[model samples]
Target chain A: MAGIPKPKLNAGQRKSQRGTEEAPFVKWLLITVALLFSLVFLLLPLVNVFAQAFAKGFTVYWDALKHPDTIAAMKLTLLVTVICMPLNVLFGLAAAWAITKFEFRGKSLLVTLIDLPFSVSPVVAGLMFVVLFGLQGYFGEWLADREIRIIFAVPGIVLATLFVTFPFVARELIPIMQAAGSDQEQSALTLGANGWQTFWYVTLPSVKMGLLYGTILCIARCVGEFGAVSVVSGHITGKTDTVPLHVEKLYNEYQGAAAFAVASILALGALLTLGLKTWLEWREAKLETLAQQAEQAITQ
Target chain B: MSIELKNITKQFGGVSAVNDVSFTVADGQLVALLGPSGCGKTTVLRMISGLEMPTAGEILVRGKRVNDVPVQKRNIGFVFQGYALFKSMSVADNIAFGLLIKKWAKADRDARVAELIELLGLKDLAKRFPHQLSGGQRQRVALARALAPKPDVLLLDEPFAAVDAKIRQELREMLVNLHHELNVTTIFVTHDQEEAMEVSNRIVVFDKGRLAQIGTPREVYEEPASEFVARFIGVMNVLDCEVREGVARCGELEFPTHGVADGQRLRIGFRPYAVQVSNDLMAYRHFAVLRHTYFLGVLLRLELEFPSGLIIRARMSKEEYARLNLTEGRKISLQIRQYRVLAREGELLPPEVSVTHHLGPSPGDGI
Candidate 1:
């Protein structure tokens, strides 16, 4: 048996119908374009830095690592990260708990203020700290007379880095905490658990993975923070220089090999961060799978 | 273990969720708070568990007031409707949670956890997380977790509502057995009437934020106190009727009634199974066949049309069907075997007033 003839299409009809047939190809083209852009902007820079670092063989890289100024910069960066990461994590947890677990006026306003650092430029963030603690700024004379220097010092660098990194942990933690509903806490309360006990036992365990992931991100950002720390540290060669500040100074002073050497360390740190991120993402995926399974089991 | 709720009322905003409700649950007895959604049965359970506080009233547990006492100090255990198991913990660890919070010794806590694992049939799944367990297994784990600490009182809010039908039946039986074995003052909340009837020794029916009735399940089902209770407990057919000389007159028929004055209009109700259907044409019973017949596995339900054009359901067993050879479109005579009269509007009456009257066959006599 023969089939019926298909409907005919006009020019306008064919033009309008073209998109649906080419939709998949269009999507693939868009993704490929984005991937190529990211490769040019991101991966190429890291590969260039590695190539530059190894241009004069490993001797120059080893000599740069042995340099006292480079050692001091690395130590300062490590110290700031170790000190600031935990503080940010703690404050982030407190802020998230306050925003999610309690009902108060101006909650949305407070949350916006917590997210202010993300929108603020790092240089402007450093300038704000300078305006607050510089020689002519508020509390400047008192701190200066007391020999407790803040601006143009390590303290200023740490402060600016901390200001820039504050929102990283909190921003990551807030949504995770919000998605875990209040049922478990209420259950704990009804089962004779006090407020502290409920939070410690029920609430903490549920958000532990998210909290750890956010803390790791905060540490990574604090260690790699450049523009803000540069403006505040004054780039004193062996006194207040962080890794990024030292790299900038070396690059400007015709020390291209040394700059790439230092840049390679930051690249390695970024790689470690990528690994941590992957681990955390795997954990999140596992949690989601388990949740879906639980839902299916309940329905069944 | 006696719990007294004195004029307890809870309001959200200006709307009352539980309004001026008062009842006592005796020690070691299981009471089911039965109602439809938004009727405040779950709210009442929550208030009693201290998850929610009443807007006005006092709660006394074992003769001492506990309205101001925190949940932890009150020593109550709650099994939520969703189970709410800690996903991070294994079944054994979940059951050991309350004991650990109480600072029980490690050895003692482990022993208690082991005991509950065996008692709840979770020994095989002891090391498995909640996400790894089946629905029935999860429910058993929740029950074990709630009961591990030997709480002074137990509260369950629709604990079996999330399970499948077959599992719900099994869980209901297990709940009844656990209640008896533990002898803890327990209050179970559910909207399913069959669940309440099966699991509770006494049932407290609520309607629109108020207590409708509190009685044994048998009494509530067999001798409901009001129209609402009668209609809610089981399948009751209500019809408009007039009382004359202690008898109800309905659509060319008169049946014996009690406590209804003459010339008074009232609503009358009877259970579907209480109706007697017969195929004998010589019988002088007062009924007409309506349009449809519903065949339930063990019983056949017939929809009867009276001369007043009112439809009523009459339930006949399989044996009765075989005896009468009943089928669709067949004319069958129905006799009102038992019924109750309810008061109409503007009549000064008790909150729950019903006049039960049985005509024709005596109790336990079948057609």
Candidate 2:
């Protein structure tokens, strides 16, 4: 009877507060429309990828994944990610440190240049690399004389992936580093720590979580890059072919299940990356709440 | 002098943030750089700490010119306003960062950390991260960390600006006690006049990127060097008046001037504490109705409006208010005991030019 009476009271109270609330009909309509939109555009595509991958059987899917070409593509993609992650992290840390901690001429221009990869088309990036490193392009004769093969090789794929994923880590880190400020670094310096020591102990640790989050995003982008890598890879079967290029080649040759199987691996990787990002965000929020609680404790 | 800034000037792209400001901190003495926001007090503190290089000047620590010395080699302690404790580090670790960098023995470093932790009353918070501590607690941690290295000089930039009012008072007392106990040369920047006065042995006031006055708390308060210092340090009633014959008149208030040209405009200022009030209308030479009463704990600040519509603020104790039975709109007699002839902005006036006006018979009516 108490529970029943509570609902009745709540109903009256809600009706009294109806001025601030949306109409029930409009609310439900919007919710339903959003759910339907996600189901059609997001859920269906994801489900279709898995379904097509396993349409024949698990054996066919397993066989496709075990193919030498697919194995080569996986290894190549992993290699590229391993090579690109450290370089991008280094670049991101340097760029963020410089932009946030100092005043210099053309700082804004440097920031805009760091974001150039994000705005420019990946195809254009790959084409620029080819023009620079190809046999008929600038520095081509010099490179030929040294017997250096860059475009249409594993190095080309790595370069393409690097260019396409350049901004991910830096973009993630800039706002965090900016908000954290240089006070800690100054404190470190005043505490008898030199520049490199201060950065290693103070600045780097302060932005560790943000750097990790950014690195994850950068890795995800590096793993999935297609357009630029495609232009520079030259479709070399076991040498230059990345995961995406291999998937494209399999599909073009009517190996639909094989292609979808490889695509599912990428799709699964993206889902895992999303999960990691969400977890990082949750941890960051929890840390903030702890800080807020500390403040509240002080006020109390 | 433990720290001496000689003709220090810092310019950001030709816009000077700190002008040719020079000051010295005696060894083991506490000093404050006090001013309003954007007045370049913090810039002076930063230059001393070697955080910012002065475009033109020499910084000497213990009589050594340190303009070319890097911050790390300077061996100074600096506390930022935000208490920039490393977020990832525990309280103990943050305090020991400098010691570790200096390569102190593990046992000695631990002893120093424990000593600072106990000294700062952070016994139970040794393992707690920066985010897990309160603002006041974080401020103490920052102070302890700065003090851990036992540097020659300690510089703080607006140290208590981030804490609540009540906690700010506690931190001020803690800093004063710490400086006394350690006997370290300390210079802190603050815009709060009361905080500066309450803590430091001497205060250096700034106005528009230039040093205004540097003196003991009493000297700076009682004998302000300029009109800016007079108004900025505390509440002062300022009036612009023209000299007529031998008297300077603004409204109903008049001050006798000596050797001044007639019709010469002058700015004058007096503190509210200088205005004496009495309940009886005939007790003083002038009378006015009380306009407003502002309660400031033990003291009451009353606004007295003259018959000519000139209002002046007078401060008295609450006990005196009760004794006089003073209320808003009550008629009261008031007298300004002293006032200073002020110089215009950017003009220098000797602080000793304060004029004393005694209550005597004048040509005007006693009413």
Candidate 3:
């Protein structure tokens, strides 16, 4: 058994072998491996976040959060999330609608372009906006004449957040909406419901859960968005600093406890996102069950 | 006319889904658009309901041209094949959906919804979601929703196609009864000929994106305009025949081929019940071998094969098939009790030429 024997089988035999469930030991081994993977990749980092945040005890963590710079970072992060979520969600609705409802040319191209932001580096996304709006970039002269500060200001942070989180909602909705097709909406239309009515009543209700799920993911990305926001924010404390930026500043200044405390807030934000994501998944599963139940109830 | 499609042609890209189809549905008629799958019957239903825009032609609803009108303004209620009841909406909300969109007052919407719910026998399940209801129940909800808005006309695309046979039968009966009670210009599409024949006052038979025939169910069944209609409407036996002395003859049977000259090749068709089976050889000129006898409870179906191996189906009671003891491979005397000259080789025969030379005329004359 030290050197595994290669007693090969034909394709059919191999297929038949695959049909059986994994052995108890093998199943446990795989489960253990998966657990280890998640613990190291996901759980460990999460635990470390909480541990570091609480390293200096309750007062220090509270003080770190209440600090003027930290407060500014928190507000900026929340504002970025608030502003970014709706914009991405709006784009998501429009993109999902266009991709699913109508037959259009360059549809696949548009879809591919939607996923482009997901594949592109967040730094690259930030740079692309910077190159467009920075002093010496494409729209530089026009913006310079008005003395507009989008490069190292809140607007730049918003733009970077927007770019990073753009695909979340649309990505969630596209496949679901495509599978749904336009049958329900078409029914509404034939029943004297106008385009807007059909969307508000039929289309919106069906996609509401997926939209929420996507919006949650989008918010998670927006709130926790670091690389893109960092590259654009210029790290001007109490003015342009997001929580992640503040964490970096604190960490760079060797203020380990303050940094961890700020990191804990962002960690909590991440936890919230994960929690919402898990909840949305559960809700979707429940919806699926209800849908299946309806189908069975009808056919049964 | 409740709905009229004049030269309606729907082209999907370069492919014609419904080609030059023209027909008018008279008000208060239960007209079933009957055809095989992919025969564009659904497209016709959609066009009438304003769900689909015909590439060419005018759609008139209540004698007003609706070609430019959007589906919402057409005020048509369409029930889909899958029963397209809003899965998320409660049965009550689903029904109230159209009414709400139409801006009906809350009181009236409630009353109308209640009326339809009761009309469609969905009283107890009013508050339940679509997923909670049975298939038949969902269909009832869909019907209630469609009719709730008091649409000018109701169009159902394969309404009973989704149900089991027992439920389908029940639905058909209830639908016929509903039509009778409401008399609200309803047009339903179905591939089931029996369902169409049972539920509709008239049937429009489509074949390969064209209207093969448009008439009463019996007319379509008994005097089908073409071979496609005859075969599509019912179980039919078609045979290539030769014309002689103004009579088209298939094997030992002869049918008066009016306006058809001698030596012309023709195709004649008849329904399963159109063939007469007798033990007496003198009763019919044709000699057929009884290839098979199937006891279908109420009626016995027979497959009688001619010498050329051409089989024609005929049905009779158990007592009748039993009396003849028409066992397998037995030579039996058979005659064309009634038949129609379906086509003249390459050309379609006129509807007038649906003469039953032997029986004088169909038992249901206008049928």
Candidate 4:
């Protein structure tokens, strides 16, 4: 009772048949422009940083690493990172857990507030702490009488780094946790697991990947922070100067090879962070494959 | 009563998910809350498990009021629709999690896990995580995990909603067997009528957050309480009729409407198997033209179109249908041997079973 249907046209013919045929030239033009923009703006600058870093060779690089001020700056950066990273990680985990696991009034507003630091400029973030803790600012006389040095000290630098890099872990975690859902936690509770037990056995394991990535991003930003550290640090080399601040000081003093070498350390740190991120991704994929293999083995 | 909901109601935003629902289950009873999606069956199950709080009314587990008890303290195991296994933990560890939380001895926990693994037939899959198991196997693990703590009650939310038909039947059978062995009071939510019929002894039918009917599977199927239950539980053929002098009259068929008033509009429903068809001209006093016939392996489903444009579905055995050598447009006499005056909600609740409606020509005459 049915005749043979007409053969479906191929893709190109189908597009023209539907009267929505887009010009191929425009597509190629967009692709080319995107490629050119990325190459000129991103690729070129990254290449130049490394080229200038090793221009005077390995011995120059070694001397730059050995400089006392450079060593001091590295220590201070590491100190700030070591202190700020854990505090921010805890905050991120708490914030993500609260926002995802519960329903309360003003919850959406609370989430947006956590992301405020990411949108605010780093220099403006530094100025906020400086004003509150400065000699002539709020609580200034109280702190001055107490003989506590905060504005031009290591603590202020740490605070500035903390403010600028606070959202990374939380931002990474919230979406993943939201997608993962509360079924598992609810299951744990029904299984007689308390709130803490459910969080430890169920919630934390699910969000560990996000936590790791967020911690890495937080560390990268904290170590390389310049504007905020520059404002709060008072530019005191070998004391308050972080790695990026140290590089600026070296280049300003006409130490071209040294500055590039110091900048290269920051660049290398970034590369290492990138390496760790990829390794984590590879591990995750491998875990997935292994789980699939296990499933197949059971079926067989 | 093992568990009871006294006028429980749950409101989300401004709308009620569960409205003024009440039920009680005896000890070791396997019951099902059967309904369509968004019918609040899952919400009722959650309230029983203490995972969701009712906006009004009281919930009592055994004799204690558990309205304020959190899910952890309620000691009611819940199997989520997703199976909610710990993706990171092995099947054994997942089963052991509840025991661990309750601070059972390490030795005791292991022994319980081993016992449940053997009971659930997850022997070799003990070390495997959730993703490593098939859907049925994961459900078994979820069941085993829920049973690990030996809770007084277990609530399963659409436990077999995510499996193939063959596996679903097997799981249903397995669940029935498990309940028999353990004899723990259990309640499960499911939209599948066949699923509820196969596993649960008691089926609570819900429609739009209201409890339509609650009875044994056979009772609900054979004697549905309301029009909604009649259509929802099984295949039913309903015809709009008018009551005239205590008789519900359609085109030519009339069914006794015992207590219904005269000149009232009514709907009469009957199952397909209730229709008796014949080839004789004056066999049953009512005749229809056979519009279509489908040869199913177990039954022959026929659509009989009447002169009044009303179509009635009738099913007979394949052997019987083959002997008749039926075709389309054939004159067939039909007699609705049994029928129900469809019950309206809140009107006398459920109509009593009355066998006095012998309002048809003899079935022997139809042959």
Candidate 5:
């Protein structure tokens, strides 16, 4: 401490200090704009739907819950989300691992292909799957000949949901995996850990939180999917209609109350997702603190 | 425990980072690969630890060829300069990483982790995360992690570079004691000559992807094979000289020569502390102080100006300074406590120059 003297700030340094003081204000301004946009565009609509759904007291809630069509749509949406979320997570992990952890020709092109669905219209995504597996599409003829239904059926709805939500997990995971670097994996290899052990003990643990967060987002997207599911589902009552599609069908039939009731259920899922996001952020912070302390103890 | 690197060469897109560098580390001996930045000291360590494979040549551990062996199979412990502790694990878990990898029983792993926790003085902080610890503590965890496996060879890459100066000293002492107590073959890479000298039993001086010199710390310091080694291991004053009649003449002074014929031109070197200063320039020996006195705790260093205007440093103890009453603008006598006569074709001296001189108090002289 005595060897090196701290220099006093000059006029330029003082000006830079003033700039630093104003930086937080600029950051806060941007955050306020984002929060305002979400409140107006998202939270407001959700609140309106919930207020309408509860306006008739417990009668409307029980009536919607008892409706056969409403229950069927809810059940189908939950089933699709349950099936699609894990599939997307697996696909995302594989795609991210391939793009980031391995070297191959056209890797950039492959990444672009994985992200194609994000830029494509959801209706187009559904049509692309329809062309590949619909009754008159490529594999549709063979499937129909075998009496195996795809389009306008439950499987078709699930496939369309899968396509629309394809990139969610991989999109979240690739950057995190790349940022984590291969140092941990290399360290594990040097420690005599076989490939599987290295993955389970080191690589997987490092990316587990990222994987879970991405999976949650995937589930949210899968449950709320409408455009793609509508294109392939054919709106079969008590069968292929999902919750979002069911809401649209009810709204068109002049059943505004039932529409609002079903919309409220999906809205509840959005709230749950927000809660999951917050929990994931807290876990990330906790992990970071643990990492810092481990570093300190090691160096000490 | 001896390690041998035979003609090991690593090239990156037409540039050879390490070129045909060969050396051996005997069992239980600590060797430092000393060099300037980009001299491939770290590359050599990485190759030895199996972090990077040599593009050409073979690596043998204890006389067994292991060029293609995977890093983990090599059983070598590596401590990165940044101390790469797993951010997700606690101090105890980080140390147990290798033990867990080895599939040691839970009881054994726990016991080993506890032993290391105590050994590293982290028993109280075992549950702590890496971020909560200081720089020195992180370094200890990295060391403990590397040592937990009881590796065959330990490789450290600039281990103390990240720590504060105060902690660096403590870590250096800890490393010296650890090396002795563990008796593992250790290769430490550092650009700091003082650290290398204090921590290593032997030094391998590297320059431009080549082995400049390799010897014990005393050998390298006393008889540096080249000017690079001389300037690198410690402070030195290399003066241009001419050898004649078993003596090397530098400016106005002549000193006894080594390994060169008369009339051959060469370079002469001496340690700063070997030079003596006096008020009466002509009354003393064949040396002269140039200008300015520098205070280096316990010693006074004077920049001496030869007749040719070349500058050299001279160091004297405080008691010597008190007795002599040395000050700025005062004349002084200089001598070499010890030095090396480098070969002409060697990296230090030009081929046209052929002799060198080392002068100092003769053997048995207390001063």
Candidate 6:
């Protein structure tokens, strides 16, 4: 038998034969385009907000932060978050548990309804509350008879914000809970744990990471919401205005420094959320690696 | 009876999952619900454990009807198919979960967990989370957890289905030993016939949501009441033949009609071990050429091809194969020593010939 001689090639041909990657020039061109795209659309706007806020002297920026209206807006924002976070978390947990852990009629439709907020326009969400609670809306006469106000007030602002951010936590939890399955809960039940005990000890702990991730996202979204809160706030500065609505009011009144300064706070909140998400991903990966090492040690 | 299921039927969205299934497990006996996947064996186990409700039946646990009882209150330990060990809890915590739920004192809970850890050989894994343990280790932990509460009855769903073959064999032996030591009324579901036969004292076979047979392993293996059981339990060569004159003829193979009407179609099944092969072509009345040989460790499976395009599986020892110089494509003579007339699909078996009958050559029949 004759031995087949190996083929020889130059460096250029050898590189082409190594993999299915594009040519060097094409690869670099694509990377350059993507980097420039992010720079223009993402990095530029963020840098501009901080840059414009500090363009004035430090005293001006500090004064903008110290303004009574800005303080009220910050407080209102925090108040809305405090009121909405727990409600949303409880609702999200219930919704996700029902959808993932059991089979019933209209389950897929319920999942779609939970995601309705994400797809519906924020202004429409605001209008939905207005139509329900406004003076001319249904149950409006009964509410007016009781002298309770909802639309065009702080309560209205909270309601609109809740509608817009309703799906965040539930969306994050559904896939996590679905993937983990109902087996552990069933196992807990078979071990003499009642329904509540199974949920607390087995289901909740398994999905805590996803729940935390979702809470961070929901808080970030709730704090930064604009269109819905603005529609329902009636531009009542120092009373009903959240951080986003107040920022818009400041910019509209030619208070550019104050608006940019207020905007930077929300930007920082987003940065912190991103950092927390990264930390969670890192910790989860590290835990997975440790588990793998333990398993390998057993085999060894 | 320790547990009795009477006329148990389960329907999912109008489709029957289990239909008219009835069985009883004596106290301190290990029984296996054996069937293929989607055969409702797992559903039967779940209904017994009170995790699933039977659509129309009565489940009696130690002579008490428990149809409406919740799973937690049923006091039945259930091991899920996937083990389902709490990923967030350590092995000791998982085993102690049941004991704590029962309001046992901390000391007693710890003592029980320690005893189970020692019994299941999980001493070092007590502190490790479920993710850190191996598949076989996780299974042992699940078993220990289910057993920790000292429930009167224990049910397992495909307990060894997830492990590798070698570990599966080891786990089967461990379960047998554990059952012997703890003498609890145990019922386990498995699709592996060998596991069911090796682990349980009694086997209840299922076919398409109905109870096909319930008997000892030997009875089910030797005298399968239906055609499905005969094929599902082990390797059996089933042939469709028509009786002509005094014999049932299937291509080149013939069996005694066993009192069947002439020209009537009959089904006969014979085990591979019943196939007797001789090196001399004239030794037996029938001849076939060896086509393929499969090695199954100690036993050799031979596929023999007759002239009429019929193939039959035969098993022989390695020593006999070597002594007779049997190889593929070699001609050999074979005879079927025993076979049974299998009941047709959905038909009841005739009591007389349901058991296999031995046949000898007829007198004055020239070879």
Best model number under DockQ = 6
Model 1: clashing residue pairs? Answer: A192-B72
What are the DockQ scores of the candidates, in order? 0.44, 0.70, 0.53, 0.73, 0.37, 0.80
Please list all clashing residue pairs in model 2, or write none if there are none: none
Name every residue pair that clashes in candidate 4: none
How well is each residue in A175-271 modelled by candidate 6, as lDDT tens digits?
9999998999999999989889998999999999999999888898889999888777888889999999888989999989888998988888988
For candidate 5, the C-alpha RMSD (Å) to the true structure equals 6.5
Candidate 3 residues B200-250, lDDT tens each? 999998998999899997788778776777766666766667889998876
What's the CA error at residue B90 for candidate 6, in Å?
1.9
Which residues of candidate 1, in runs, are more than 4 Å off? A1-24, A141-147, A283-300, B240-265, B346-367
TM-score for chain B of each model, two decimals: 0.89, 0.93, 0.87, 0.88, 0.87, 0.92
Q: For model 6 chain A, where is the 10-residue window of minimal lDDT?
A: A14-23
Report the error of model 4 at residue A146, Å: 2.8
Error of 1 at B338 (Å): 3.3
Order of candidates by DockQ, top first? 6, 4, 2, 3, 1, 5
How much lDDT does each candidate structure score?
0.84, 0.88, 0.84, 0.87, 0.82, 0.89
Pairwise TM-score winner, candidates 3 and 5: 3
At residue B306, candidate 1 shows an lDDT of: 66
The Cα error of candidate 3 at residue A299, in Å, is: 6.5
Better of 2 and 6 by lDDT: 6
Q: Write the per-residue lDDT of candidate 6 for residues B1-367, one digit (tens) a residue.
A: 2999999999999999999999999999999999989999999999999889999989998889999999888888899989999999999999999998999999999999999999999988899999888899999999999999998898999999999989999999999999999999999999988888889999999998999999999999899988788877877777777788968788789999667778777778898889999999889999999998888777888888888878888888899999999989999999999998885323634422223232121111110
- Candidate 5 lDDT (Cα, 0 to 1): 0.82
Off by over 4 Å in 6: A1-10, A13-19, A293-300, B280-284, B307-309, B322-332, B344-367
Q: For residues B1-367, what per-residue lDDT tens digits would candidate 4 score against the true structure?
A: 2998899999999899999999888889999999989999999999888888899999987877999998888888889999989988988999999999999999999999999999989998998888989999999999999999999998999999999989998999999999999999999999988788879999999999988999999999899988788877866777667788888887767888677778777778898889999887788888899988866667777888878767777889878776877778899888999998785323433322322222222111111
For every candidate in turn, the CA RMSD to the true structure comes to 6.2, 5.1, 6.6, 6.1, 6.5, 5.6
Better of 3 and 4 by lDDT: 4
Best by TM-score: 6
lDDT of 1 by residue, B173-278 (tens): 8988888788898999998777888789999999999999999999998988777777677677666677789877766557677676898777777888887777
Model 6's DockQ? 0.80
